[model samples]
Target: MPQKMVEKIEEIAEGSDDGLCDVIFHLKSQDLTLTHVVNAGGVAFRNRSLVTSATELLPPSLEVLRERQPRTIRRKTDRDAEEPSFASTIARAPISASPLEETIARNYDRLATAIASAALRPSVERVKDRTKDRFRQYRPAVLWSSESLRVALRRDDLLDLRQRTDFLASLNDVYPNQQVGVPRYFSPARSSAKVQGELSRVAWGVERVGAPAAWGAFGHRGAGVRVAVLDTGVDASHPDLKGKIKGWAEFDGSGAQLPRSRPHDTDRHGTHVCGTIAGGGHSGQFVGVAPEAEIYAGLVLNGRKGGTVAQILAGLDWAIEQRVHVINLSLGGRTLERVVRSPFHRSLFHAASIGISVVAAAGNDGSQTSGTPGNDFFALAVGAVDVKDRCAGFSGGGTHLITESEHIGPKLLPLAYSKPDLCAPGVDIRSTVPKEAWGFLSGTSMATPHVAGAVALLRSACQGFSDLPGFRQSSVIQDIILATTFDLGERGLDHRFGFGRVDALRAIDAASGWVTDTSEYRDRRNRSPVAPPSARGRLGRLPGIGPADPGA
Candidate 1:
């Protein structure tokens, strides 16, 4: 811990009430159990079985939750012309044959016993291991991460723990778990206005992205692909969403998975997002991009400021169990931090490693603003555009600095990449709402599902193609979408519109005609400086992942 940071933590604690503060500890080893960590004096949060639920769902181990980290692109040096592109730098590790449900069931008893025993008084032998119980006064409720390599807990003595050198040195890193919400726009009245009557026409957004063209060409409305929406929840009974839902789950305030939870929305945000992804025809109008895709709704947010980061991770863990092809995150937090150290970022990385494409909302905060998980390298960040294909003023955009972090890397040099990987129609978009009604909403939140649904469609179109796993891979899909964009901002990749507004028709075409050689696809992408000359040009000239062009 740096001395300046220690002072800052104490300073923040000075004016705060004595409520529990959420903290995440990044462990060095995944094998350390709750009892081992607590007995080793590594956790500042004391065991409080009464405050924590015994019925908490056990998180999976790192072996199940994470695949190996994907290789990332770095700055090109004079002697590095032959260097490989980050898109296919390393081969993907095979996903476990064991389903997430089986893994969870198998580890349930081990974690239950560990948590129960850790709550008891420290044994004489265990007590002898530490000099003293410095964190004993703090009765914090702890939650084990799905990866099991990290532990998140709520403690009342945040100020006290940071000052103790012994406690701080036990973990690799620590992060504050803050509640994040859907992007907020300036004119909230218009962005969230609930229109009176349902519009019986296809949304302008669905038309603008050319989703209909893809549907016509491929004859696949994302039938075989599965997508997960982690948000407030969804309105399962909405007219357009009746048969779209396949699975549902919710995380309580304490990050525990509630058993027998039904599909319901605490707010209208989740329902609308889900509708945009796969909503079927309502009032004779088709509103969804991948109307035939299966939907998995996970309620991680409850329309309040109290929703913690742990809930999101739990939802992500559950999504993996469903073997979803795409994940729609219509919510995120705005921050200017250059490095990625958050648990959600790690989960996104793991999701990408296992061939799950994640679409996130660039914050509604305008230019120069960056949002976590969205701005994260692992995500396919999306921005909002209007009917005219103009980037929304509230859409977040900027060049994010990818610096070395304990979780991400020890890089030779920091890499800068333009954010909001692409854009989609968000202004005045109409979709489903709660109480089996329909409404209009705006913001990058509305735009994210447009892209998520596009990924589902691509996955569905490319089904049975074994060689182009790159087509299903996050980085490759990200590059392909960027390559096929309609170029909304500047000439090339820029801060506002990234590569540009997403073009689903062109993206699907590129994916369909792409060379079956996945490695060759990566090699060709590395050599091309500009996004291959649009869909009109030769299909062989596809895009690659690298630093933004210096001139652009």
Candidate 2:
């Protein structure tokens, strides 16, 4: 590569958004390495010549180098950085002098920024188009109305008509007379038997708190709670999951129609997650976190293995309108600066205000970092822990929470402070398979649904508490789960385990007003101790068995 050509390539790449460019040059030297960044538009590259392959290595190949380029630029003048004086002024005003009023004002300002950004971004439109397309193909039974149909339907006999064969036939071109089963799933006899066995054993009872044991003990079995699994579309017809799936929306630009059952396991990841959250245990094989919770499957990620932030937001918005009680997000990526002004986060906040609990998996990057939306405080960010209750090697950590200002610009960047609110079993967990089979997988993606299911259990058990008049509503359901976790990572709440490992039985007990002592809890990651013989046996029996036993 010539010096002049190198400088020219560098200039073009630097000037492009995200320091990327698409151009090819025949280098005079074979020792030069070419690096390129490629996107939908095309590819860009940079090359560096070296005396030997080992010295600096040839620049990446033109193809490889082009694929690495940034798709967009981060500018100081980016709209997200500008302060909203009017909204800020209104927010800071001493209106009513009440805490609630102040909170509302602050939220209003945040909402304003989010809305503005949504209006300006073309990504939002693309996401909407994709979502609408998917719905048109599968689950076409779902009607889209420009007006408030839920309200209008409430005043008419539309819901009643939905139960009528002729009306359904008129509305849907396929299987008009087919009856849709109730979304929730449960087995009183089976649950009672499992709960009794756990209660009879001390260690088992203690370890599985807020889990199936707790779920079985209380009759609040996720009766009315609706959970939105935002990932690949679910196998709505899987025998174990058939009636348990209530609704679905595809944001993959294919148009929504009846969910396909054949290629249910295309990704396999989402199906496994769905099983973990609501699998009916029909084969006496696997049971979900909240067996009776209604599930609304949203396919945000496509078969191609990746998706954008916009697609995720569209799924979230639809979930909110459906009044889903809990949202389980198991996918994430690097944080973008514009995310703070994202309508997606604002919608999540709106859902939170209305009692929706959002649970997301921290990235599997194996560092003290978090991805957007998951990084958002309103969403309960979860990390991965092994069966032995040790932090998974790939789980991300948190050092400090990023503020809105830091997330916006200038100094706006992801902070490496304390993160990952809590950890759960993320390594080698087995769950439902798309084609009526079962498989094991790993990642924080597997960890998130654990919390989602736990939330469903809490929702079921806390019906009375939530119904209580003026109970102070001090925290969201995510907070309750975090506060009740068994603190095990460090002196207090640190990055490894934000609050601590999730104990289903304990969380449920806490919801019912039963508190426990946490002084004896230890961080297995830092401690030099051996598990008791009995504990070792129990650990060995855990679902997923990894090669390296950290506890050992």
Candidate 3:
């Protein structure tokens, strides 16, 4: 009786050359009929009646074809003689039940009919409504500079305020430094012989000494390690990073920079971070943390060092989908949001929950405020420490802070924590930049990825460790890194240096459980000799062993 129902039946009939439609139509009168018509492509034939009934037909007119049967049949005997004829079949016979059951069943049948009709009609209205609802619920908060806003507004006038450039520019433009810098030591073309020589002589930190030193120590070089750098996009075609760079996703809808086009670094921050983590050795020039580790680059921020929460979220989601083992987020923002509640935080937590370690910069604000992604417990929040192994003056201090209605107690606020978890050579550190251009910049941003690169080395050394069941169930990697640090600041676990300066060589030695101890003893002749313990265990414990079990 409904207009939509009629249209659906007509469509089905047209598709079948006026043969009985797959769906059955039942009216209050309980009458049924089967009509047939013939057509030759564009040539049409008048409708011809095959069978008509005054009462409900015996098979109820809803028939499904057998596998071998042609979809359309011209003769009735051809269908009736087939295996399991519809006439002998019995479908859902009316059941004598309670009124409620009858009503429910009737409604369900009606709903199914409506669904089938709408699907066949192919209306875009419902899809449009869903799209609008999604936009309303997840509208991203944009943060851009005034110049960017003007460009965006001029580009599209129909966009709503939330999508408009003027509105995004009005928000706080907190993040600056968006360019990648080239170190003064870097040159585009250094001889391969020189590069290999530097690689052999470079004083890798204690932790990194083993993997590069031993062949097949774990797996073959660069077999399964995956390091994803989520920052500015990478130069896919860079000669040094050709096949080594894998997987890419773009969230920036604007057609400014693409995968093939390497955007000029406005601040050199991302390139520096990338170089530190996995810069390929070019000629005899700069090398990265894990030179052989496979690198995946994602550009979340634009050239201006500004992006919406949505773009960042998209980048994170893409990274997780790639199943990267290590994610380095060398950026931060001030927020006390929980990963469980915020979508952005939730995305990061999801990645970590699946065994991917996320590392983030504490912040450069020089306040006690921990930034958003860094504040997430799922991430390893790294703070800056100077060359003297003292907390950098610009590093944030941690103290008790209030958050929401819940009186969350004291914890190390990321940037403001009195003592950083560990210190690294943050001042005058060198790394990579875009346009083959490199420079040096200072901030906690430069320090975070150092730990990420260290993790990559550990991952390489402990082949198949991540794949083992419950490998990351404990804080093995975290404790090993802390125990290997060389004390530099005030005392043990002071505010300036949480533990001590990161010693890569020491860390590698610790991983192997090797230690060398020196102790002074008085002899019978009133003579004393200082005998240092070998790089082995002492006092019934391993040399690298600390108060707490590193593997535990």
Candidate 4:
């Protein structure tokens, strides 16, 4: 590359970092020698995955169990199981009120110094002596995968590393970590018309989507299905969430897992999202779309700064490890132009490839504003609608042009997917909040959980759907939902409303019919090739799919 071009690329990349100089490097090889060169330059690296085999090289203080663990490690049911000291230390540490960026920086500094003193020592210092000595203190934040590494490096050192032929040959790409946050928007105050009795017990959004109807007809309220809520965290003590939280963990801004994490919300956003997904109707309020579903809550965001791309990815990796059936990301972040290949996109693709239904919030910026992960082709980006089934004013919609990553996922298809796969009730949505309270929120964030919960219901109702090949399960479910939706805005798939507002009863009926018969199947990109008619249509009622409930 020309010097001017390298300078331009570096300048563009500089704007994306959170002032921590944190950048992720995807190398062509998992060889430690490539990393050793960087490490010897006084750069301390924290391994999230790659260090497993290097356990013997780790200091005695690490105390890693020598026993080889399976790649698909099951969630430890016994809380007493031994954990890494780093996790336990964090578990015992007090929650700091410091700025997230500053806190993360401090943690990295401490960790780097510790590793230098304990692990690196004389050998690393001797190697550093032979170098040009341009490098100073650098921190190891996280090792995302065997080939991907995240670290805090000085600008000059980063430039130097890029110029090295040895390093450059092994490096696939390097980019600053992006910031992520809840895609929530505030709505204007509306008239407080009080409702009493049964009508007020169940949320209007829940009823509008016909969740109760689907539950009664299919006899499945997402039973035996697992949904991962990657957000602030769920309030486990909430009445509606009792007996619903099956697993819980927290991730730092660097995407490292916090030790001994328990169920607790740093903000009400996560609690509300979780409630809408699987909260039991214990408080006489049927707030959740799938009341019987189990939750695997990962606290990826907290306080004002929210979180970073690394944190969300860590939470996502944790969710995938748990073998959850569905994932709800009620959050998003800007996709920078400088990014040639997005780690988040690849992660979503990996999740979808394994049959997990990933639902995300279409950003709240309105019009042609779409956020990443949601904008990614694999994610089922959900838009927002009001009680009257009108698209929310702040609902984001746009067409994602395939510019950088033309080939994505196992299929190697050009994933030039559009925004808002479907819409769901979001305006004035009432659900459980922290401190045992119920409140109303309006955003695409709120709508996302509705779709996620619906996916859970579909998974439970249509058992063995996982037997479908990679990505087929989620694609089929998305197809059923899109086909059964009540069309709004444009005639077919449009920006405002991708298909239309989700109709749970109709979707479940269609899924039930398809799974029972399995005679007709379609494979296409962007939209379903043909919409499956309603129960009363020409196809009539299949053996399992019955007539739509008159009460719905």
Candidate 5:
């Protein structure tokens, strides 16, 4: 190609249109390297299949996000080494303060608490309560005591960030007993490697998680309950995934639905994850964890062109609106982002509080690595396990824990579980692809759907589960899922195995009374990681994701 054409191509490729870099690179066995990337929550444009961020249904803040503004704009030297961290603030009504109080919560019952504490506070900036009006739609769902509140804020300028940081410094002295919120982000948890498995017997991943047993032995196949797969859009026309799609939609950066879900699957991530969750086994070559379950598919990622955090939050918000019983997020970005933001985390907690079980893939960033929403407190993070039940090399975990999650599980998990909530089959997993094809993929992404499908089956087996009190249904479901796991890795909740490999059969059996100890599933609200005394404004080195550049 001529030099002018090459420069023109570079310009267009580097320029993002509506959140997509739209790079068209031609490598005739000569080209070398390239790059670029992008997350979901919400229901706007009630009837329209797709809506933009500025759509009337979206909150004011989402409009800003839809523009895909830079994630942070700081001087090169000022930027800290990016590390993934985000804070989710879950609150109810305020309690009487005393020496006995271990932490302080922002607001008792208002959606504005998270924003005000971080940026709207009088001490932080002159912005004051003005910022809260922009994000009232992002409030938490309260079940037992009061509503939950989780918020995310943007620093429009150096002065804005300066005020926020200065306030963070005195957080210890300001509210000695309260927990400050953490900023959060969302990324895709890339896929796994392809390996050979028995084409005849049940798909190894399905068998490994005992999906067949949940079907044949108990006659449970995730009926009634609905599960959502938030990833690259699914190939709705695939034979196995045909009628399984109860509802599906695509979203742009700002959480608005797409015009309509495409029958094509340029990105097979969502299709494969859906197949693992509830493929109809049209080819008889692959089986899903919950074949009879209803599916709610969201195309958060746009094929190879990466998506943005706004896109993800919108999908999540929509799934909650759709009242999905379980949601599986098989995508994520780096586990090393500097500032850990948790608007995504708070949304997950809000979804869970409303009885929606969320499962996310631990990123592929290997051991001791963690990232965005997956590392958030509320998301049930799943790690990848090969057919041999060994943790996948790319599974991300082992850094820090959400203070709230530290007290979850039937038993107290070891601190190593700062990342992974558990493990499931992800290696060499065979499932439906686009154009009626079947393919094998591996990653924590694949492992996530297994758990999500399991959640559906357990919900199907349990009667009157929905009638349970707020947080009770999700808590019981979580308990059954965690306690039934077959132990592995370090004899306890190691970074890799978390609560150990998932046992779908055991979970359903205990949940449906095939086994005893139904009481083990009770909700234990012991630890409050949110609004805790020492929780700081979870800050990190903001990278190119912010203002200076619309993250490449």
Candidate 6:
């Protein structure tokens, strides 16, 4: 709805006639409370909010989230050439929301409810967590986010206080309202076949993503890169992962960092992920995507108890500080609403800004959208595909809501931005387990490591890819990966296949001085000047990798 805005003169020249001000604005559109005002008492602007209710009038929807998007026009220049014109000079309709407003609008409902509920809670600690040890289960919690916003939510109002956006300026973090969990890869446990050479020889996932072909041609297996796996700790002593664990840390159930913690794997998940990433493949066991990538394992998840959002955040912060080439988070949280922006959204954005590739799993809930973090647009979210290129039934897929802020939505199949960035093999995959053994497990979790390992390989093969300005580096690598995929389910980028099942050889070919080929991905990524001189005249040269191209 168009608001009834009352314009106020914000600034006036010294003793100007009739107190003239250039721009007029309204401090508050609702309640007309003018708590935050401009040009008041000789002050340029003053924010004095005595707001009785901080709640926005309505919840944001995908339909209205684009209100703040600026309009652009092609204007004729001196040489009759067209140049893009900004909305400000072109007299287009004004964008309704600002970045601040967008965040507030999207989160107002949930926060309001949390605040209201908190006001009624008794000031007492609970005996147990809301879901007990089942951290993967979704529940309501209240967390404060960003410094400017203050939540009146009572300490006990929300169950997960740490997950809330912190009200104190000391901690400027966005938080979830519930405990988040690493995606569960629990299927029936593997039998002795996990130990014998039966299922251990060749990782089907590595082949599914075209890793072997890349190995044969490019001869790069992620030797010069570092990868951070935030999960249950890895078994450093496992033969296949004997020397893969480089840096190690553990987080308590409360998510506190134990900087000097020892490497441990109470459960098999992280070890399996490690094995799939850089396992030595001794004893005929199939090797991981990037077998030689250094691994930094953050023991965020507990063997007996599931993981928490705070632990994940701590581990991620550590990884980003380490500046590892890629960070893989094979976990997700079931969200309450379509317009949710969990706290990790900001964290993921930070990692991206610094040029780190943070890959996460599209949840296994099989819901309409993927969970938070993975759903975040900045993270390289992955979905699960089988050897046959079929989308897994348990693999999460749905439509994601896209907003003008460019914050990514879920990786579900229904909406535009909600689909997984890409798909990878996630079923019946074999990798090293406890006791120097091998095992089979499945989930978007399994699929996520494939992409993470591939990133290590890509970063090693193409130094130029990571050397770009931090923000552009990940995009270029993503473009390369997306550019040379084997489209499945749908022809182009879709909810199921994402960019498509990742093709390692094609990605290697593109990164290994082969981008000059005439493929869609290469053509799109081949920009001059923006790219280094070494990249000039190198794109769109080779024949495109088509559906039936040899070795495709």
Candidate 5 residue lDDT tens string, 1-552: 233333433444334333222111111111010000001010000111121111111111112212322232123232211111110001110111211111112223232443355443432233224446633322222211112222222223212433344333322111000111111112234423223423343567876676665565566678888898787778888889888888877865434466855645557777888899998556665468888898888877777665655567667767877878998888776557433434465456546556788898888878977656677656788988886688878888875632222113322232222558679988777788788877777788888899998888888876656654334356446655765677777654567877678877667655554123223322211211111121111101112111111110
Q: Per-residue alpha-carbon lDDT of model 1 for 1-552, expressed as tens digits?
A: 456446644554554454444444443323322222112111101111111211111111113223334232243442111212123232222222233355455444443443344322232223223324633322222333233222222233455556556444444455555566645633234532222232235566776676665665566788978899999999999989998899899986545688988999888889999999998665456678888999999998887553667677778878876778889988888776655444565466556545688899888888988677788756788999876677889898787664543332343235456677678888888788888777788889999999998888887887533333422255456546666677665765577886677777767666664534344333333232123334223222212211121111
lDDT of 3 by residue, 73-163 (tens): 3343542322121111111111112232343355345434433342322222332343465433222222110111101111011112223
- Runs in model 2 lying further than 4 Å from the true structure: 1-210, 253-266, 336-343, 400-417, 468-474, 514-552
TM-score of model number 6: 0.64
**CA RMSD, predictions in order:** 12.2, 19.7, 26.2, 15.4, 20.2, 15.9
Per-residue accuracy of model 6 over 1-552 as CA lDDT, tens digit each:
011111001111221233211111111123111111100100100010111111110111112222323232223332111211111111122222223334345444544443344422321122124334643222222221211122212222322333332321123222322345556775655433432333234566775676655655555779978899998899899887888789998876444576567898978888988888888555545558888899999988876777766566667767866778889888778653565455565456446545678888888877466777777746777899765677988777666543322211122122234457678888877787888887778888999899988888877776655434444455456555655566677555566766577766666655554332334333333331022232212222312211111222
Choose 3 or 5, whichever is better by TM-score.
Answer: 5
TM-score of each: 0.73, 0.55, 0.51, 0.71, 0.60, 0.64
Residue 123 alpha-carbon offset, candidate 1, angstroms: 14
CA-lDDT, candidates in order: 0.61, 0.48, 0.41, 0.62, 0.54, 0.55
- Write down the worst ten-residue block by lDDT for model 1: 42-51
lDDT of 2 at 282: 61
| TM-score for candidate 5 | 0.60
Per-residue lDDT tens digits for candidate 2, residues 451-481, read 8888888877776435311111212244356
Model 1's TM-score against the true structure: 0.73
Say which prediction, candidate 1 or candidate 5, comes out ahead on TM-score.
1
Kindly report which residue stretches of model 1 are placed more than 4 angstroms away from their true locations once superposed. 1-16, 29-85, 91-167, 185-200, 304-306, 337-341, 407-411, 464-472, 515-552
